[model samples]
Target: MQELAERAGISGRTLRHYHQIGLLEPDRVGSNGYRYYGADAVSRLQRILLLRETGMPLADIAGVLDATTTPAAETEALTGHLEHLAQERAALDRRIKAVEHTLSMRRQGREPRMDVMLEGFNDRYEEEVVERWGRDAFDASNQWWHGKSVQQQKEWKARADALLARWREILQDGHEMDSAKAQEHAAVHVEWFKEIPGTPTHAGDTAKSVDMIRGLADQYETNPDFHVAFGTQEAARFAASALRLRVRRLEPSSADDLRG
Candidate 1:
């Protein structure tokens, strides 16, 4: 058991916890009370670790594994997981290179470029994009982003940054969520969301667009990345509140339904 844990780079306690939760079981236990894991157990552990990286809960992962019976099924599952890891690795590589270039520029007494800083950040909400929209929506937007020249990407990012800055300024000016100015800005924000190639907004699916806006409003209030982007937690929360109001207006008939 200790050897298996060491091999997997996880502690024995974690493996034991998995055992206690019925998520994993040792192949056998010695009379002296040590646990042993066989090859099948090791393979299961690998899958568990990979699925967890995708933010899946342990219960869902157990169900997924339990349903995957054949060698071919295991291979298919691993292939999908590998693709997700590759996408994340590519994003990380771009961000790393961007930071490295910025460091080099700073050492040479040059200002780091904002456009260069925005590279690879296009995939920041891949999980949310996939969950709210679909894999096709994510792939379409990803393709749209990568197809842009560095200059074009920078221009798009500049518009997005300006919009967020506007939100921050509005909140700083003490605009209430239901205030006229705040509601106007929220409407503009919804229109801006349609600029993306593959979203419910761009597709003109008003109902889906309202749903997407609601989900994103929740994210803005909860996600720390939005806090940093909006320049403060207060601004993020305000943006979320304003967005919720805009969506409710968009779907007045569903306002009561959305309250829960």
Candidate 2:
């Protein structure tokens, strides 16, 4: 157990907790009551760590692991995780470069341009966008955003702010989740995503579009920035629930051909 824990860069106590939660278990127990893990355990731990890095909950990771019964399936999942990590690394590199440029500007007693600031901010999630969709997805969106005139950008922000205000009002009105008015707002919410240049929804990739919408809903529920922007945690949660229901109504498929 100690060896596996060290190999996994986690403490023995964490491994024990994982066992307690049934997220992971040793291959066998020795006669002396010691925990033992084998090569299979190492592989499983690798998968667990990779999925954990992707921000998947332990329960969700367990489900994914359980569903990966064949070697082929496991390989496919691992490949996908690796690609995501690579995208994240690339995005982080861009963010680092942006920060460096900002520092240089400050040293020169010059403020960075608005475009530079937005570039850094947008690049902050470039890798995440790439991982969620692909490089072309990020590139297309980035180009579209950067190509906009200052007036257009202001208009876009105003529109977004207005939409958020409507969401806040809806939550404050205490409308039930299943209300027609709420569903109408939810439909507008989904439509908003379709305007993005690189999203699967924009490309009409139904499966990936639904998946992306569902993921964004999860983020809106749990992300602190989203909570602050949306008025309250409860409001964000309500919005997430509504978005999830809307996405579920989309055609279901495992296909993710929105690589571009």
Candidate 3:
């Protein structure tokens, strides 16, 4: 047990807790009553750690592990997760490079260009957009966004800010989730999403459209960015619940696809 714990860089107490929760277990017990984990256990621990790195909850990880019976299935899931991690790393690298470039300019008493200053942020958003949608989707959307003039970009941002403010106004007024007023706002929300180019909504694929909306609704509730966008996590959660209800009405058979 101590060896396994050291190898995994986790405390024995955590190992015991995992055992208690049935998330992991020792392969056998010695005659002296010490628990032992074999190579299989070590391999399983690797999978557990990998899934945890993806921010999956322990319960959900267990479900996924249980469901992934074949080696190919496990490989496929891990491969996708690896791609996401690689993109994240690339974005972080870009940020580091941008900051280094800025610092070098500062030492020479030079001001960075607007685009150069924002390069890291653009890369970060690009990575996220590509991961959530697809490379082609990101390409089209990125082109459309930068295609706009500065004034046009600001105006678009103003409209988006207005939409968020309206959402807050409705929530502050104590409107019930899935109520008539909430549903009306949901329609408005869907239309706002439709305005974005290269999204599933504008792709003319019904299933993907449903999926995109559902994914956004899920993110609004569980993603920290949305929590900040909505002024509070509670508000985001409420909006997500309402959106989920409204979207379900629009597509009755669309199921939840929360990632594990």
Candidate 4:
């Protein structure tokens, strides 16, 4: 076990923890109580580490490993992980270039352009938006966002943070999802949604906005990241329910037609 741990560049304790959690187990255990791992164990350990680098929870990692019953499946999963890592690397490179531009401009005694100042700070949700809504929608939204000044962008982000914080506090206070305050909060959420540049709400299309709100409600309930952001899966579900109810109440004429 010690040799295997050393070979894997992980401590013996971590190896033992993996064993205890049924993540990885030794191929054999001697009568004297020492554990032994084989070459397969080393390969599995490397895959586990790679998945962990993608921020997958241990339970999800186990599921992914279990689901890869064949070499083909394993290769497919690893390919997906490689794509994710590549995107992360690209984002970091953009951020580094943005910072370098800022520093160079300062050294030259000139103000940095808004584009240079805002690079890499925005678009964390670019991939998610593109996947959910279509490339055209994402492109329009991204273009609108990049056109804003740094201060405007910061103020917009601050408003978003404040809204999330308010929801967190409201959930922590044990308020019911359909309570009056919760509905009011949902109204504010929709109002905030209207301020975005590329959405249907911004275009004064009430029908499309209703559809978007319903889609958002479903996303809040189902998206794992939303659960993480909102403090819990249950909290996300609550927010979804509140938003759905508020949308139904505010746009009763279109409520029946709103698609999830």
Model number with the top lDDT: 1
lDDT of 3 at 203: 61
- Tens digit of lDDT per residue, candidate 3, span 1-260? 99989989989998888788888889988899788999988888888988888865688677667776776666676676677778677657657877997898899998643331112124546787677677887777655665678799788777866765666778888998877888888777777766666776656555776777777788777867666667777777877888788777877542332110
**Cα lDDT, all candidates:** 0.77, 0.73, 0.71, 0.72
Instruction: Please write out the lDDT profile of model 4 over residues 58-103, one tens digit for every residue.
Output: 8867877888667676567667767877867765876787799889
Give the alpha carbon lDDT tens digit for every residue of 1-260 in model 1. Answer: 99999989999999999999888899998999899999999988998898788765687677778875765654666677678778778778777986898899899998664431222224666677787778888877677777788899788778888887888999889889899989988978887777666777767777887877887788779877777778888898999999998888768564343332
Query: Where in model 3 is the C-alpha error above 4 Å?
Result: 1-133, 252-260
Q: How high is the lDDT of residue 65 in model 1?
A: 80
| Residue 220 local lDDT, model 2 | 75
Model 4: residue 80 alpha-carbon error in angstroms: 37
TM-score of 1: 0.52
lDDT of 2 by residue, 1-260 (tens): 98888978999998888888988888998999778988887888898898788765688678778885776665666677677777677667657867998899899998653331122226667778787778988888776775688799888877766665677788789887667777788878767766778877778788777777787788778877677667678877888887777666544532332222
lDDT score for candidate 2 against the true structure: 0.73
Pairs with backbone N, CA or C atoms under 3 Å apart (clashes), candidate 1: none
Q: What is the TM-score of each candidate against the true structure?
A: 0.52, 0.52, 0.49, 0.46
Which wins on lDDT, candidate 3 or candidate 4? 4
How big is the positional error of residue 39 in model 1, measured in Å on the Cα after superposition? 44
lDDT of 4: 0.72
- In model 1, the worst 10-residue window by lDDT is 113-122
The TM-score that candidate 2 achieves is 0.52
